[model samples]
Target: MLQACLNGGRMRDFHPALPFTATEIASDAALAVAAGARELHIHPRGPDGAETLEPEHIAETLQAVRSAVPGIPVGLSTHWRIPPGGLSRQEPIRRWTTLPDYVSINLIEEDAEDMIALVLGKGIGVEAGLWSVSDAQRFVGLKDAAKCLRVLIEINEQDIDEGLRAAAGIQAVLRQAGSTLPILMHGDEASVWPIYSEAMARGFDSRIGLEDGNLLPSGRMAGDNAELIRAALALAPR
Candidate 1:
């Protein structure tokens, strides 16, 4: 599956075209899906143009996107940086009155286990995010690790070689731990295109969008998420 991470922690300062409101996100969703994206992941923002975990914000965002693209599988981020009390995913998970089809939880977080348990209880699927080899072990050690919807192998290393190496290391740990869940892998800005191509080469689900990076494989800034998805599709093997 090809997912589009519409707007992450990225803001207007990073790119003027980054979507902030529900209507903007919904428009991006419609265009991206039309261009071949199979799934969506978004970071909801507040009235102040800052990332937010507020239920009203999430509901408005989800509702708009769902209305624009009825069957698209949407997911939200449990990023700790959003709230004033940084490093707390549990708080948002606790406060959420609205839920997405799934949510991404970084296993490197302090409250990873508890938050995962809570999300599962709410009948919301979990995207076990592995940011490093250590994170892979963290997921493997979970009580019902296999029950997660999918594993997200995210490489933050900007150096292409180092990032690809990081991806391999995480994958090795998961294999050693007998993890059989499907993987949705992608990389940081400098490594995204190469790693995305690698993911496709290995038959793994991959993603792209403003959240990942603004650049295309040719090193030019993408016009939008739809253009990014179209470029990604061309890289995939037929």
Candidate 2:
């Protein structure tokens, strides 16, 4: 599946086309889906244009995007930075009047176990974000690793050689752990297409968008998320 990560832990200064509001997200989602994105990853923002976990913001974002692009599964990045961790981070999920189809949580973060249990306990699917071999090992130790919706093998390494090496390291860990969970592998700015091609060649799910990069595979600045998705689909191995 090609998931479109619309906007990540970033603000408007990153990209003017970045979608923060529900309206913008929904519109971009429609175009991206038409361009071949099967799943949506977004960072719903507040009135002040900052990412917010407030139930109201989540509810509105989910409702608007889901309503606009009916049938597309929409998820959000549950970053600890939003509320700066502790009970504050977990409280909103507990108080959510509206829930997303799923959420991607950074497994490397503190309190991740508690957060995973909470989201799972709520019956919402969890996408574990594993950044390194150690993170993959940590996930393997979980008896419930198989229950996760998917494991995101996020290679943040920008250098192509190092990024692929990181991917290999984590894959080795997951193999040793006997994890059968689905894998969504991807990278950022400089390594996006290389990693996407790797994921495609290996038949694993991959994601792309402004959050990960604003440039197209040709090194051109993308006009919007749709352009990126189109480029990503075109880059797939035949």
Candidate 3:
């Protein structure tokens, strides 16, 4: 299913039009859903414009989006304000609630197992986020693969050509795990369109939004998340 990454890992300094408040995010979520997004991925931000894992912030964001687009599955990122060694802390995970349909956990951080366990115990779906092939392999190696909930393999542009190669590696890992779990692939920044098109060609579910890139396929600034979704749909193989 196509998802809309409303916002994640973004700051006001990165893009002047990036959505920061619940109101703005709600508007974007509605537009994206109307544009064919079945799921919504969002990262709640605090008043200072920094990513926040606070329960209240997440609640407000979820509330707004749910009010705007009822019944659309929503997911939140657990990579909030994550520092080099901050994943071990229980504070962030403690704040997560079932309000969001899914919560993404980056494998790069420490104590990933514990965090995943907590999320599962809370009955929340998990989106295993892989930034590199190594991370994908590690995820595949994890025991009880069924607990992952859902998986989203993220290919960052900084990895360059390795991005597509990493996607292939992830497919291999999924094969070895013997899991037919739903997988979605997408890229960040200027590389989003290329990888998105490639994802569709490979017959993979995917997503797009300001979180991935603020520019449209035409290289112009996208006015909103709907614009990006429309661009992605246009690029999808007919």
lDDT of 3: 0.79
Give candidate 3's TM-score: 0.91
- Can you list the residue pairs that collide in candidate 3? none
What C-alpha lDDT does candidate 2 achieve relative to the native structure?
A: 0.89
Q: TM-score of each candidate?
A: 0.96, 0.97, 0.91
Candidate 1 achieves a global lDDT of 0.89
Q: Which residue pairs overlap in candidate 1's backbone? A: none
lDDT of each: 0.89, 0.89, 0.79
Candidate 3: list runs displaced more than 4 Å. 80-85
Kindly list the per-residue Cα lDDT of model 3 for residues 138-188, writing each as its tens digit. 777777457776678888855567777877787787787787778888888
What's the true lDDT of residue 130 in model 2? Answer: 93
- Report the poorest 10 consecutive residues by lDDT, candidate 2: 80-89
Error of 2 at 189 (Å): 1.0
